[model samples]
Target chain A: MDCTIVKIGGSIIDSPEQLQRFLQDFASISGAKILVHGGGVMASRLQKALGQQPVMVDGRRVTDEQALKAVVMVYAGWCGKNIVAGLQSLGCSAIGVSGADADLIRAVRRAPVPVDYGYVGDITPESINTDFLTLLLRAGITPVFCAVTHDGCGQLLNTNADTVASCLAAALAQTGHISLTYCFEKDGVLYDKDDDSSVIPEISSGMYRSLRSEGRIAAGMIPKLDNAFAALRNGVSEITVTHARSLLSGKGTKIIL
Target chain B: MDCTIVKIGGSIIDSPEQLQRFLQDFASISGAKILVHGGGVMASRLQKALGQQPVMVDGRRVTDEQALKAVVMVYAGWCGKNIVAGLQSLGCSAIGVSGADADLIRAVRRAPVPVDYGYVGDITPESINTDFLTLLLRAGITPVFCAVTHDGCGQLLNTNADTVASCLAAALAQTGHISLTYCFEKDGVLYDKDDDSSVIPEISSGMYRSLRSEGRIAAGMIPKLDNAFAALRNGVSEITVTHARSLLSGKGTKIIL
Candidate 1:
């Protein structure tokens, strides 16, 4: 059976209705699938409530010791468990996990050079344990992962959610057909920034280059699209950028090679 | 293979050096073992930090919605992950889990009768999923559990840690010889509350009744011992109450029929 790697951003996660709808769609998938989610919006909000200032370089939060702890509590503790429980309620057997749980993903603490991204971990394709993941998938258990990873040396590192999804898709691709879906607030890669309905139906590699040159793509969408392309290059069969509530449909932008 | 169910209370968990030493000793156990931990101390501390009051009725904390969220974050998020990471550092493949993770333990929400225990969950021996747990253990993965369970219908409920351990021990007893161990602050059941060396090395059910009747046992130790005896009655072969740092030895109190 084909495996679908679906990633939901903070927008869908922050809304109960959107999350419930998304999970229902996710649970209805015919075969093996994985759901990777982002809870950064909630994490940042929580950080503020704890009187800690959130440091963001570009769109990525700088994960200091305090931020890491707070985010782990928000993401893994609240967000991940709620999702897993919701899936369980929907007759879907999903196991919530962090990288630290089973050493499922052995990541490296990102080197401090251009940015001192404290307690941030980055994983290569080598870091993914397909054998371990395959075991769970084969047992008909859906693996719902939070955006936290570990260095295999007693550190729980906060990694980017989109990156986590992309890396997982690339690594799991070694075994079978993998479709990477990026579910976000917008329906797709919008052609006009102000127009919600002006989603680009599809974007080919050549067209992506032209759009970038013309500055048509939103700045925030670049990193995610870049991740999608990276996954495609590595072996993921398809890439869809869509609204989470509208998942299980080709209602958004499809990235083509 | 004999399975050992080891439960560590809040005392050991509050100290890092002690916890590390305990985990190291726990990692060295001869056969399949499960680690169940308590985080009530930390939960209380966190509850206060969040400006919430801890309400205890008849020695059990009344789990309000706010307190339940705090404790879940403290137990399942901060406390559980650190223990799992520590075990991983010690070369043991430990997976941190909450009941919500795999539905490993399904519990009934404590009903509002004598006291309104807002979000507490209680599990019987039948509530534990042996087949699923057996799969993890057979794969050479140690299951580390936090003091959180679910209603199997989506509600994540706060559970008593000591009760969780006892119930797990008795439940797992059907498949193999199961030993239940409670590692706490004192070396064992103490003869004198203030004396470190006053460890009661052994206690029979008759002796426990006499000790309780004479007021020799501390008030806090009663419920724990009660749980231990209940596990014993339910088919658990051996129950040891010991110092977490001095585990792997008969250094604590042994409960005998």
Candidate 2:
């Protein structure tokens, strides 16, 4: 069976109205589907509320012990459960989970050599438990995942949501065709940063190299595109970057090999 | 198959060492089993950190909007995921969940006619989705549940963990024999509030009534025992109140019909 994996960014999740609309579209997706989400904005806000200053390096959170607790609370607890509840209200049977739940994803703590990203975990397709995921998909249940994974030795680790989605897509692709979508605030990869309508319809690896050389692609989007290309190189059938509202509209930039 | 349902109170959850020990014992329980947990102490601490004053009426949290969010973060997020991770480390396949997940347990919002408990939910045996739970149990996955439930209309509500355990036992009893256990700091229902070793081996309905009439039962134990009796009336096979350490020792107060 074909599977669809949709990952929503923190911008969409931070807004209740936007999240509801996105979930409505997500619930309408037919076939086996999964939702992976990031709650960085909320997690940062919670950290501030608790008097901990959030540190970010190169657009990635520098998770300390305190920050890890905040993310676990926000991502797995607040955002994940609320999203599941919203989907359930729309008549979609959704199960909210962290990677630790059923050992769905086991991550190794990142080696703190170059830069110590405390409690951050790095994962690949090998880390996913595809058998259990297949079981859930076969049962007609949509899994809603938060970017909280666990090391097999009983430690919860914070992971990048984009990495989780891409790896999950790659893992699921082993059994069947899988499509991965990255949904955020933008329409797609834009030709002009200031223009909303300047979405580039498609991008090839050659074009991506030139775009990077010309500094046309935003620095922030580099990691996402890298993840996209990696998923493509693995076994993912297709990958797209699009606005959250245009999930089923086929109005996103599709990545090409 | 026989199933065991155990509910741990907030006191045990607030201490890391205590919780780990409890999970180790909980993991060794054979057969299909479930864990229900309460994180009230942690929730209250988070609530205070978030600048919300937790109000309790009759020992039940009067969950306002802020308190609701705090509990959701603490119970379902931090505590639930951590417990699942701990159990997984102990070689137990555990899945952490809130009531909203897969709509495992749907609750009705409490009516305001009785002093308004802002966002509280009440559940019964009929509220449980036994089919899905059975599927998980048969698949050898032990579910770790927190005290957060949701109304079918997409609202998460605070629920008493003891009620969740008893109700789940009653619901699962429809298909098979179920034993419910409530574990806390105390060895069992005590004969005297001041005496730690004065554990009551057993209590019948007659003794319970007389104890309550004589004011011998602790005020807090009343609701838990009430839930136990209700579960017995509703078809649960057996119920026990025991200390967290004596889960498998067969030493505790047994409730008899």
Best by DockQ: 2
Clashes of 2: 0
TM-score, candidate 1, chain B alone: 0.96
Q: Candidate 1 at A209: error in angstroms?
A: 2.7
Clash pairs (backbone) in predicted model 1: none
Candidate 2 stretches with Cα past 4 Å from truth are: none
Candidate 1 has a DockQ of 0.72
Cα shift from native, residue A103, model 2 (Å): 0.5
**lDDT (Cα, 0-100) at A148 in candidate 1:** 87
lDDT of 2 by residue, A46-85 (tens): 9999999999988999999999999999999999999999
Taking the tens digit of each residue's C-alpha lDDT, what string does model 1 give over B192-238?
87788998889998999999998999888998999989999999999
Q: Candidate 2 — which pairs collide? A: none
lDDT of 2 by residue, B191-222 (tens): 89789899999998889999899998998899
